[model samples]
Each structure stands twice: as structure tokens, then as C-alpha cells.
Target: MPHVLIVDDEPRMLELLKLYIQPYGYTCQLVDSAQQALDLCRQHVFDLILLDVMMPDMDGWTCCRLIREHSNIPILMVTARNQREDIIRTREVGANDYISKPIQEGELIGRMEVLLQQQYDGLSYDRESYRCSYLQQKISLTKTEFELLGVFLDSPRRVWTRDQLTTMLWGAEASVDERTIDSHIRHLREKLRVCGFPIEQHLETVRGIGYRWTHQ
Candidate 1:
């Protein structure tokens, strides 16, 4: 069973998410605060996190941002805020996807299923040896980096948030910061640049949003 972390302040909400998701072959870890969630993330690994936007101490958006600073675990923001700006902000904070308040069981399941399947696909490949060459020099990538680039290569035009990279690459068993992923990307790009590779266009940065790989 895939381990899942459900971060919400409300006891009822946590219970609801657990009850709804348990039947789908997921193990749920319930927490009431963002701090506690982070504490849990430091040690135990979770496949996905269902985060609530509004919390007592630190809101889901802030928590997600902080979490992205370390791990790229996929976060699904569950919120009652239906405004466009709120949803946009959720994405800005590195949430892979967002679901509005009063979530339906079926809809939530579908989203979780899609995210989980994507993660599985990424892990299935031999991440260690997977490499890309630009120009004439060959730059080798670590398994995590390979998975990060895998998402980029799979969708060339898409910009992936730090959270997406963490979830797809690290999953629930390992630990690493999202910024560390940025470091690797920088190193990867630098290697490519020095190699006179023409594929640099594939690795694009979207300012505050995230990174994109757009090479054909």
C-alpha cells in the first residue's frame, strides 16, 4: 500500500480524507499541523500529501512552500477557497494539483490515481544509467535527477513545480530538499552549456513558477 500523509487542522477533515482514501489501497498518516507534518516528513516517507489551505499556525500554502524547500513530495491542496487567485497561489507555492473544498470521493480518487500512476512510471525506468547528451559532451545524471528530467522530457512544454519534482523522484521513502534538485539542474545545465550542446533550450526557467524542459 502506498503511504499517504493527510495534513489538515480539522479532525473531521482528516478523518474524512482517510476514510475516503483507505479503500483505494493507500496508507494514511494523519497530522493536525504543518509543523507536525514537516517533522513526519523528516523521517518517514509518504507517497502523497493532502494538504489543507487554511490551518491554524501555518497555512497549507506556506507549509507547501516550506516543504518544497526540502522534499518534492506531491502535494494536493484541499481548500474551500474557490477564487481564481487562491488556486493560482496554490500553484505558485509548488502544489502539483489543487482540489476545492467539499471534495468528492470519486474526484479525489481520480486525482490521486493519476498522480500515483505517474510516479510509478517514473520509478519503473532505470534511473541511474539514463543520460542525455547535448553538444558533444555526455553529462551523467543521478537517479533523482534522471527522474526530474524524465518529467520534463515527457512533457517538453510544461513547467514543473518543485513539489512535482520531489514527489515523482523521491517518493515516500527518501529525503531531499527541492532546492537540492535546483542545484542539480544548475549543474546539469552548466555541464550542457560547457559541452557546447544545442539542447540547452530544453531547460527553461519560469522565474517564480518553476522549471521547464522544452526541447524537441
Candidate 2:
């Protein structure tokens, strides 16, 4: 199940959002302040964050900026103000999207779904163009490397044995070897490293098993 962190100062608003979100199968952790939210983010992995713009202590904008410094988790800011400047400011602070207060169930859910589907931490990939980017910096990849990275991100933390990956990417009849798979992983890691992502920590070897993708 997808995990979400909901940050809002208003107790009623927090509860209402939980009620609106829980039935859709998202598990949530609620914090009443942006500082609490930032602290929790460092310790937990969340698929998305619902951040309230008007908090008494640290505002959502500051929290979002701090989170972006170390994480690529999707952030959707919720605010009463719908001015164009406010919307632009959300993006400036690295929020993926924003929503107005008096949140409508349909619109809120719809936006959440879109962000969840596109959640890839800091990495963005274009399958058609074979383009990959980490934190807005371009990372070049061969078609095979691109496909390999796609498989890993598609199922984070699912360890794939060499044979499983070979069959899935190539075919049962294809004669790709285990070493070839290792090479692809190495190249992918190096590319991400060059783009300044700590790929070593997020991508792990399963010792005698295989490999999996993990995140902070």
C-alpha cells in the first residue's frame, strides 16, 4: 500500500483529509506542524506528502524546500489562497503540485492519484525518448540500460534474481548472461552518481540473491 504523510496545523482539516484519503487505501501519518513533518520525512519513506501552506510555526513552503534538498518525494501543497503567485511559489519550493482549501473530494483524490503514479523519487525517465534525469540533471543511458533502470524503479524493493531479470527483459530463449546484468547496473549507478544522486545507498545488492531498489 502507498504511504502518505499529511501535514496540517488544523486538527479538523487533518482529520477530514484522513477520512477522505483512508478509504482509497492510502495509509497516513499526520503531523500538526511543518517541522514535525520534516523530521518524520527523514525517518520514514512516504509515497506522497500533503502539506498545508498556512501553518503557525514553519510554513509549508520552507518545509517543502528543505525536503527537496534531500528527497524527491512527491509534495502537494494545500492552501486557501488560489492566487497565481501562490501556485507559482509552491513550484518554486519544489512541490509537485498544489490544491486549494475547502478541498473537493473528487479533485483531491484525482490529483493525489496522478502524483502517486508518477512518484519516482528524484529520477525521471522518458521511455520513448530513452532520456533519464535525476534532480533535473540529465543522465545518459543506452536503451538497454534505460529498460533495466525502468524495471527496477517500477518495483522498488522487489529483489529480482539474475534469471528473472534476464527472462523479463530479454526472453527465455535469449542468451544474456549474469555478468551482463551486473554491467548494466554498474553503468546505471555511475550515471546517477555523476548527476549527484547517492545511488549507492538506494540501490543495493542482495548478497547471494539479486538486486533491489530502496529509498530514504
Candidate 3:
């Protein structure tokens, strides 16, 4: 069962979201303040977070930034302020998506499903064995290497710039040089090569751009 954290100042809003999501097999946890939401996140792992933008203390934007410092968990910002600038700022502050107030149930559920699927689909890791399933093969990988491969596999064929990979692997606040990305890719490729996967053919580099994972 997927667990979701819903953060809204209004009690009715929290109850409504719970009512809509619980029937769909999602476990919903509600909190009235961003601080409480943050505390819950620290104690438990949630598949997605529905964050309200406006609140009495510690607004959603600040809460999002603080969470992003240590996690890449998907966050969908909900707010009555639907200006273009507000939406852009939400993304800048590390929100995965945004939704305006009075959200449509269908759209909200669809977006949440997409985010959760992207985060969980096509990747299964066995921490005890240090193995990951990818391309129908179970291969061993270092923690860092597995994370990099998981990102590429999650959105196959999508171009990932070095900076984006750095941000996704290490948080935005971490200092990671672009060259370090190349080194990690090199190591990842070596591990894949040992497993008889054609890393060179599938993991292609776009000159002057970044890297992309493609199946031949």
C-alpha cells in the first residue's frame, strides 16, 4: 500500500483528501502544520506529499526546500495562488508538481499516480545482496552506482544533464562537480559491462548535452 502525507491547515481539506485517497488504497496521514509534516517525514517514509502553500507558520516553500536538502521525495504543492510566477517558484523550491486550490479529483489522483509510479516502477533493489534488477538482469552495484542507474532506468531515453543528475543523486545543496558525474557513469558502465549488458550502446552520451539511456 502506498502511503501519502497530506499537509493542510484546514481540517476539512485534510479529511477530504483522505476520503478521496484512502478508497483508492492509499494510506493517508494528515498534519495541520508544515512543521508537523516535516516531523512525520523524519519518522516515516511516504510515497508522496501533498503540501499546502499558504499556512500560518513555515510556509510550504520553506518546508519543501528543507525536505529537498536531504530527500528527493515527490512533493505536490497545493495553493490558491495560481499565478505563473507562483508555479515557477514552486518548481524552483523543489516541488515535483503543483496543483491549484479546489483541485479536481481525477487530475489530482492521476498526477499522484504518475509521480508514485515514476518513483517506484521498473526498479527493485535487494539491499542485503547489494543487487538491483534492471533490463531483466540482476546485477550487483555500489550504492552510488545503483542510485545513478536507477535514475537513468526510471526515465529511459530522457536526456539527463550532468547538473540534473548531480542534483538528483546528491541534493541541490550538496557540492558536486560536473566531472564527478562522468566518473560515476564510467564506473557504472564497467559494472554493467561485467554483467554482459551493452552499456556503451544503450547508455549514450549526447555531445555538448548530457547522457541518455536507450535500448537498441
Candidate 4:
């Protein structure tokens, strides 16, 4: 079971998230403030984070940047703010992903999984703990990402649709949208590129249907 931290000021949101995630057999921790979240981060590591962006103090954007300074934990910023600028602002502050408020549960979980897969590098799960080569350094990925990526790495020629990837990874835990998958692919490819990995040759788009991995 994956451990996830959901930081929101709204009590109802926290309860709703708890209910949504409990059935998935995940350990869910709910915090109501940015300060509490930071404190929790210092205590233990979590698989992923679901953050609310409109807090009263130390808002999500600043918190996102601050957290990234100390850790690379994938963060999904939630907000009611709808402007593209708002999304971009959160992204610029180092959020792994962004979702507007009144969120669709399916979309949120879907995107969250994609973010996890992308951030964690989705490969090298054969070993108890494995490291992937990147820019002459080794970057460690979580078990989930490592396992997910292992599936893709082993079959470089296979194409995977959004539903396929989500179902394969999250099962009933979460269902992701096609666009969410695309975003993860895009983010993962960029990360790989930065680390000097041959990203483009590995991840190829299959047009309207979905994406494929093709080593050339």
C-alpha cells in the first residue's frame, strides 16, 4: 500500500479524499495546513502528495517550491482558481501537476498516477533497490515508478493507452484520463532528456489512440 499525504484546509475535502482512497488500501494522511505538511515531510517520506493551493498562509506555490528544494516528492496542486495563469504559476513554483477545484475524482487520480510514474522513472524494479543512469549520475526511483517503468522498459515496442496504463498501474485505486497520460509522458521524457538519457527514442506517440515505446 502506498502512503499519500493530502494537504487541504477544508475538512470536507480531507474526509472525501480519505473515503476515496481508503478502498484502494492506501495509507492516507490528511493535514489542514502548509505548516503541518512541512512538518510531516520532515518526519517520513510519502509516495505522493495531493496539495491544496489556496491556503491562508504559506500558500501551495511557495510550499511547493520550498518542498522541492529539500525533496523531489511529486506534488499535485489542487485549486479552485481556473485561469491558465494560475496553473502556470503553480507549475512554475515546482508543482509536478495541477488540477482545478471541483475536481473530477477520476481525473485527479488518473493525473496523480501519471505524475508518479513520470517522476519516479517507471523502471528498474527487478532489484530490491535500483538506480537509473542519468547525466553520469544515478537517480533513485520509488518502487511504484520503478515497477511501472520496468513494464515499459522491458517492452520498448509496445503501445499503451491511457486506460491501459492506469488500469495496469493503479488498478481500482485510480483511473486516469488520456490527457493525464500524455502530460506524464511529456514530463518524463523531458526529465530523461535532461539527464542525458535517450528519451525520444524510447517514448513514441501513437497518434489519437495513445503512446508506444520504441527503441531505435
TM-score leader: 2
lDDT of 1 by residue, 152-177 (tens): 75665778887777777777655778
lDDT per residue as tens, model 4, 16-74: 87787667666899999999999898788787889998898788888888887786677
Model 1, C-alpha of 13: deviation from truth (Å):
0.8
Best of the candidates, lDDT: 2
Clashing pairs in 1: 45-172, 70-177, 70-178, 72-166, 72-167, 135-197
In model 2, pairs of residues that clash are none
Misplaced by over 4 Å in model 2 are 22-25, 42-45, 69-72, 102-110, 113-121, 126-129
The 10-residue segment of model 1 with minimum total lDDT is 118-127
Task: Decide which is better by TM-score, 1 or 3.
Answer: 3
Per residue, candidate 3 scores C-alpha lDDT tens digits across 1-216 of: 677999999999999989888888889989999999888888887778999999997999999999887766778899997899998898899887998978888889998876765443223344445566544477767788988887876576799999999999998998988999999999889877776665787799999999998633
Query: Which residue pairs overlap in candidate 4's backbone?
Result: 110-176, 122-149, 123-149, 123-150, 156-213
What lDDT would each prediction earn against the true structure?
0.75, 0.88, 0.82, 0.72
Alpha-carbon runs more than 4 Å astray in model 3: 121-216
